[model samples]
Target: MRAFHVTFEPFSGGCGCGRRGAAVRGADGRTDALRLRAAATAHVACQVTKPNGSTHTRMGIKKLIIFLLVLSLCLEGGSAKEKGTKKGKKKGKQVYCPSQLSSEDLARVPANSTSNILNRLLISYDPRIRPNFKGIPVEDRVNIFINSFGSIQETTMDYRVNIFLRQRWNDPRLKLPQDFKSDSLTVDPKMFKCLWKPDLFFANEKSANFHDVTQENILLFIFRNGDVLISMRLSITLSCPLDLTLFPMDTQRCKMQLESFGYTTDDLQFMWQTGDPVQMDAIALPQFDIRQEDIDYGNCTKYYEGTGYYTCVEVIFTLRRQVGFYMMGVYAPTLLIVVLSWLSFWINPDASAARVPLV
Candidate 1:
């Protein structure tokens, strides 16, 4: 009896019969042509037994069909699973554009306490209108603290001073939350533009500058009762007329007057704080001394011909000149020269050089 061997290779064409492929090799020394009925995708080898020269080609083809069917199902299931995973990821990353959202949608978004309160207060607020409008006048209280004082120049007839200018007024429009615990809330300086502020200007200003080092030197505090307070540092040069006829003994008066630029007395009025409206920090000068008693303030409201009377407040500073510098540099030197000319009379008719020089 002779034994026959069988080996299967991957099909090169589409599934089923009628596809051309390499003929299967057998171990019988005979090159008989055989048409395989197996699917084109099957890739396995099997042995066929020929008992008493009988063939088992039908049994071999059946096994190959079952093996290829199982492999094709598994490949299709894995591809579907991957497609499902990609779809889930795309749905999770979905985001809505802000421009497509409506006002009701924006209201649904959550915000912290401070941001919500600010949005409510500023939503309908107009900075152009005064607090009371045509009703009662808005009383703006002013306070000034002198940080440092510069020289009282006789040549320019002006003086420079650095000060912190503080102003307070009530709005009654910034409603606070009921659960708010603090008496006041200090806000960022950038918020200054969103609120109505007094149109205060210096009436006696020759030149002025608002400090801006290390961010703007502006502070704002909003009180629970809608009382707004703003303070800023300023370097100001004010005109001061001097009576130099008194020379080093002159006492000059310098004034800083605050007045409204737009709103008149009917809409806004200026007032000084009750106690300690003006403060000093031991300000020293080279040629003058600023006494605390000489610092005074009063209402300087006056009327104009066409324009009505506007609100005004003035702070007066009296500077007394020191004579120590002049006595040593001017009067003392003059006295020595006159005394030396008298010595010319005592020393000589004989010393011509000394006498002529002294004369």
Candidate 2:
């Protein structure tokens, strides 16, 4: 859904022009850029253009260009700035809001999801979370270049993963009319009360920095059958563990795990949106080939005080490091250098450079 935003900036008093009471200023705060430009345009049109009749046309063209450039730049910068702020402010407490339901009706609702209405987290759109494998930027085949052989080639990837948590459990208070007998109605999740949210986090994150694509419940689709579905998208960057002990000829297995925080296995369950419960996407690296994709699911049970078993899903990506890249960049160069060093051996035995053996 598209959002419409409109803000009005008031302009007050003029310019360096001798015209009295012709200046403009912001009513509340410092002057706005557009307002200042507008004031300047007005000053030019009123003071300068009035004297020279032919100059009005030229000045008008200049004023229009200035206005266009200023408006375009301001809009673009403002949008980018607003998006950055939104993505940054994602860490915070959650406040649940529900549709208007009476106190008596609320008392009738159950505290948790029953067996009949088990909520499922559906991948509404194709998820794009942490595309690389084994701490390598391998999402795109083009990024899998043999730049410096042994040196790690870096590439950036931004993933947008959207998931929907939907469950059907309706209320009589929010019933619809005959004409509005549609299966669902969409509303802001914050406005809808008594919704259950899973405790989700990226478990194998090695970096402190990440970009949150969005920070809102976004949308809540409530169906007539009492099904409540919440859809939201989140973005995060991760560097998987890489051994590199074998260098280019080595195989790597990286993991991305997701587990329930407070809720134990008894309270909640997690599964893949499709195929195997531990399903994952294939790596996009060209030089590094993927051997196999694996999934591990188990309960983390602790015998400590007030601890319970929690279920977790660990997605494993097995990658085989391409040797050709390393051979060209590292091994080949070293071999060449070593062969060239042999030339020093051909020098006179008396020379100090011949003392060292390149082989």
True-structure lDDT of candidate 2? 0.46
What is the clash count of model 2? Answer: 18
Tens-digit lDDT track of model 2 for 165-185: 222322332333334445666
* Tens-place lDDT digits, model 1, residues 1-359: 33333433443333222223234344655532221222223233222322245444786768866765675666667767887999999755544333334668657655656645555666677887889888999999999999988998888999888999999999988756666777888887877877899999999899999998877899999888889999999999999888889887888888889999888899999999989899987877888889888898888997887889999999999888889978988999999988886787688587888777676
lDDT of each: 0.77, 0.46
Could you say which candidate leads in lDDT?
1
Q: Cα deviation of 9 in candidate 2 (Å)?
A: 35
- Please give the clash total of every predicted structure, in order: 0, 18
